[model samples]
Target: MTKIIKSGSGKELADARGRLAPFLRDTLVGLNYAYYEPPGAQMLHNNAIFVRSHDYSEALSTEGEQPWKTPRLVSSGGTHLAGSLADLPYALAWVEQDFIVPESVQSLIWEDLVPSLLTGAVLPRWWRVTGNELHAVTLYQRAGEELLTASAKDEKLRQMVIDILSDRMLPQRSGRLEKALRAGRLDQVFPQIMPADTFYLASEFRRRFPNDAEHWGPAGKELDDLCHRFASEVSPERLSQDFGVPHPALAHSYSRELLNVKPFPTFQDYSSRLLAESWDSNNLYWARLTDEMGYPPVMLNRLVPQLTRRMVEKLFATNLDDWPAILRAMQETGEEFRLGKTASLPKSEATPGP
Candidate 1:
């Protein structure tokens, strides 16, 4: 029987480690682990043992000293573990205990476009994000092809991102919008790409709290409050049915544009076309692409996630650009590491969201 990894199989991880460890040593942990490299190799072996703890809000936790003897152990608290006293930066890996810790770590690693990433692992989001500035003078460019019609972008996949920030629940192209994102002068290089409303809201959010230097408070929390009200007033089905533009705040307005799909699309036809769009833009044309595809918007936003990711990945393959360096601006401390540039993104993993 084939052992599944993402769903978190302790046996499969143990078995793979046993089978692959001899020649590679713990390098097999790279198959399913999160490793970190601090400044000047601050931590031993420069790899972190990331476990999915119930209360690890410190997102980047600093575990002081670890027992290298414990190859893979699950604590009573449910956090998974994988580390070693390899004596060198010989291994940087981790595996899931009860949760898919390795998977999450891998996701972040792949998002960056360093030379070490597998030959094709660097993505447009990593490149375009610099121009768009997803925030912090850095971009998290997770986009599909330029050929991707606006409507072809999958809003369902986009909306799946958790609002960890709590405010501005909508994801914006990181612009040097507010004073806090980076030096105010960065605006000379990165033109503002966030929607005008989004920019205004983000600015308003930052203006309220002068003391929070990073603008980590997420502004006035208008997006959160609006979402809270939306939750109270609207049923999820109605929301998904009515406003399917990926983000909730844009849903109501977005639905209006979809309502006007030229020639009007039947439900099945609309659904099929929606599954094809790979990148999203707030522009009205994207919402109307199904109409252009002969699949008008008479139906609602009924996207299928599994099919969407596959289609988007195909789109991602066609047009790839190399990422630019941003070493001068950001001071990203702790747990910073990159995989081999020739290393490929792990296949067979399901990313339901883009």
Candidate 2:
């Protein structure tokens, strides 16, 4: 197993720095090492390397006639170097010259920090608006590039970033996120995405990667509101391909509901059989049995919507002829109702109506 190096902010950074100090200082000084740390989020809070910089101090200086945005740094070390810098290229040039500080050995900033910092996710501890619009644009570009790079490399990380980007709805979402989505790395996240974002992320995934149904198809299966939407949204071919005939939830729910009746043992047997078979035959057998129960048309008319509303509408609208049994059942129900009404009327009224 690759060792999980604690490399980010807080005690993790301190611990890592302490463990590899002199070697780290040597590495940083000569720039002669080929060290590539694992790709993960780095903590910039309490970053020792950036806190001692002149730009960082100026950004934090309360006495200065500058526009620093809060929350202000109260503790000893907490500032993002890439974000805090007034100008990155110029600032890095200066930082290289000033790298002879004592903290270089103590802090031992990782080379991986370069790529991780480029992710641009770490907000500055404090920043001043210096009328240079390029500062903000540069930060965005740097962050976007790293996010895209990181996302392309790891599928789960890509999904996490996609979830974050799903906040604004697609097209309206950040171009960085859009680029991430287009990278086409879709996988289920551990602990799953939050309930609110699941459907949105699933939706965006489907809209963007229509052919990659397997990725987004089974998402939001646990949510009641999204169940019908999931079924209706995907194309029939993709639905069949990805979800194995609509979805197991819809099938299992239908079987559970339909088979729950008197003649308890038979109900159980039928349910088990349908569930076990999990084929179109099960749907057909149930449809026939429901029709035989003296309400074929109304049964499907009601039950289809319960399974999925829009799908049923599309089926009935476009493929009515395909379900002759349902049509016959509906006609028979209407005829039965009319005849029963006539039979219940008084003889004089019946004769007059005749």
For every candidate, C-alpha RMSD to the true structure in Å: 21.0, 31.4
Error (Å) of candidate 1 at residue 133 is 19
Q: lDDT per model, in order?
A: 0.24, 0.29
Predict model 2's lDDT versus the native: 0.29
lDDT per residue as tens, model 1, 1-354 = 244445548887787767765536335544323232211222222334332221222222446544453244345444434444331111221221111122112222122121111111111112111111122111011111110112123332212211212232223322223221333243342333222123322333334433433222232233334334554332223322322232112231212111211111113422322321111222211122222222223211221111121222222211122001111101010001011111221221222112
Worst 10-residue lDDT window for candidate 1 reads 328-337
Tens-digit lDDT track of model 2 for 1-354: 014263365667667768777665544532311121111212212243433331334443645535333112233344434123222322232233222222112332222222212111111111221211212112222233344345666676577555654553334334544453555433422112221233233334434554543322111222223334454433323222211222122233211111111110113323422222222212222222233333323333233212221111122212311222222233333334335432322112222110
Top candidate, metric TM-score: 1
Q: How much is 184 displaced in model 2, in angstroms?
A: 18
- The true-versus-predicted C-alpha distance at residue 19 of model 2, in Å, is 43
